[model samples]
Target: VMFFLFSLAFVQGVGSYLIQAGEDGSVTDDERDALLLWFGSVSTCMLTCFRVVTGGDDWGAYYDMLQPTGTINIIIFIFFVMFSEIALLNIVTGVFVENAMKLSQPELATLAFEQRKRDLADAASLRELFHQIDLDQSGKITAREWADIVETNEKLRYRLTVMGLDIK
Candidate 1:
């Protein structure tokens, strides 16, 4: 009973959050419809999970895997919900952290990306910026700097090219 109610309440929260996302970021008119469908499906699926496990206690004389009463079923459902929620929350957390980092310190992401590229470029003695350019040791960045910070090894070059990176 408590689990069912909790699932209902949690799903309600998700529904509200989805509405807020639509109104906040306001992706586009087209995305609005898809968001609705996705939220609806997720809410329905959660409800199904709650129903499937909540009433399984009386399920006797069945498959070897299923429990005689439904305690096991409920436990299994709870575990599933726990791990699924953890993974889902991690994804949400990642998105939030990315957005927050971008908003709070926009320059950091750019610098980090450039620094990574510079490191990779430097790894093979192909540093994009000359030592003089990095006078402060703060890895100088330039539009054309991206060009030199790349590898031309056939395998890597082909992989990136296949991903539409215009490696050539």
Candidate 2:
């Protein structure tokens, strides 16, 4: 939008200059009227540019009308088309992508938090199982203790199997 407004202003400024630089440092009544009709009001210029940039209106008519004015007008029209359609569109796309990433951040965080909670629960379960297997309250399971517990405890074997540990 800013680029559109700036281009409109530039075209208006050039129109004003051309009007002032006419024959005898002044324009005829008809030419003055035509120039005024083309670049007189900001609202009109803005609507024209908006329509041209959005493809809502035919730009050939505008180009044809301004073609006789000078090369500067044609160049300004090209710049307006390039900046508004290409550059501004890319900027808008970037803003949308950035917003989408921001919106998904909480979901990503939630998934990470749930994964951490499952990991902590698994660790606690493993610790409890380790304590149960550590005979003589030694806080450690010797190979003999592990073998004896696995051989004697069916429930422990089932629990270890459920926990993805092979007792064999």
Best by TM-score: 2
Give Cα distance to truth, residue 41, candidate 2, Å: 3.0
Candidate 1 per-residue lDDT over residues 1-168, each given as its tens digit:
544554554445445555666568744554444334322454553555444344533222222222221354446545655665676679899999999987886587788999899667645443432443343565765645434444323554554465455755
For model 2, what is the alpha-carbon lDDT of residue 164?
Answer: 75
Give candidate 2's TM-score.
0.56
Writing each residue's lDDT as its tens digit, candidate 2 over 1-168 gives 674575566567656666656645554566556656655566667777778878888878677656656777788777777878887689899999999999877787799999899878878998998898887889889999989988999998887788778867
TM-scores of the models, in the order given? 0.25, 0.56
Instruction: Give per-residue lDDT, candidate 1, residue 65.
Output: 21
User: Which one is best on lDDT?
Assistant: 2
Q: What lDDT score goes with residue 80 in model 2?
A: 76
Off by over 4 Å in 1: 1-47, 50-68, 107-168
Candidate 2 colliding pairs: none
